[model samples]
Target: MEKWKKDYLKGILRDYPKMEDYYLERKEKLLFHTKGTHPHSTTETQNKKMLISISLDRQLINLERNQKVIAQCLENATAETKEIIERLYLSDKQKASLDLVADQVFLSKRQVMRLRDHFFEELAEHLGI
Candidate 1:
């Protein structure tokens, strides 16, 4: 993959957890709408709700599709590949370098790099990027 495409996939991985959380919060807010009389007519309020629901549905579909792609890639990954993903991409802590990840996963740095590259390639293909 091109450098920019690789970086883009990495960026998506990095944001995955945050994106999930954000959408969940949004979903909650949508569900918790205040019940009160408003100046707007019933049709106008319903139309507004319908538009918001449509927008949220689109966002949720995209999120779920990406999540399914990621899940499939992870399902096919080796144990060591999972370790590399958890430590390097999925963790909430600061990102680990390839050297640190290799040490933690009991592999040489070069091997870690190779595994990571392979994993990214698979992920990119799954994502249709």
Candidate 2:
């Protein structure tokens, strides 16, 4: 993969967990706000709920769509490739660097870099990008 493509893929992986966290946080906020007692009138509360619901729904849809796309790409990949991608990105709160991934996978850092590049290449192809 080209350097830019590799960087792009890494950026997406880095952002994926953050986006998931944001979605969950917003969902919790929406539920909490809608259910909790407040000083607002019924009409005001209902309006607020409706707006929150719409915003949450849109965020949920986007998160789900992106997850599905990532899932599909992983599904099409070899087991090792999939594992490398997920371990480096989706399976943890903190993103793993290629060196850390190499250690985990028992490969040299350079080998891990190659795998990452190939993984992105395959993922981009699967995404038709």
Candidate 3:
């Protein structure tokens, strides 16, 4: 009947998929926690908008730092070296051979051979070589 009761019911329903039984078992405690008591002030709700804004800022900061690292790594690298690292690290080929990567990337075995030189060159440069 009350607005607060409606909001509490809605919140519980939304969380049903994630932890159905646990939520059901703790339904009384959960409801009591959300609908604050007189002295403990269980009725007060935290601002969802503020929490979301804080989380978004965190995600954006992480994104910017990651992009900066990527740019710096590529700044001193040759295009060929970038391709080699892609094959080695990003091609789902931790233990795969160069020939396989070459085939996947549509390059020759000789080109793959050159990739090794490029990989070391960039790696060393990245590590201040």
Please name the candidate that would achieve the greatest TM-score relative to the true structure.
Answer: 1
Models ranked on TM-score: 1, 2, 3
TM-score, predicted candidate 3 vs. hidden true structure: 0.35
TM-scores of the models, in the order given: 0.76, 0.56, 0.35
List ranges where model 2 is wrong by over 4 Å.
Answer: 18-63, 91-95
lDDT of 1: 0.79
Better of 2 and 3 by lDDT: 2
Writing each residue's lDDT as its tens digit, candidate 2 over 88-114 gives 877764657778888888889887777
Candidate 3 lDDT for residue 5: 46
Judge candidate 3 at residue 87 and give its lDDT.
58
**Clash count for each candidate, listed in order shown:** 0, 0, 2
Better of 1 and 2 by TM-score: 1
The local lDDT score (0 to 100) that residue 97 gets in candidate 1 is 92
Q: Which should have the higher TM-score, number 2 or number 3?
A: 2
Poorly placed runs, candidate 3 (over 4 Å): 1-71, 75-81, 91-93
lDDT of 3 at 9: 33
Error of 1 at 93 (Å): 1.8
Candidate 3, 42-80: lDDT as tens digits: 323333433344345543444344344445655666676
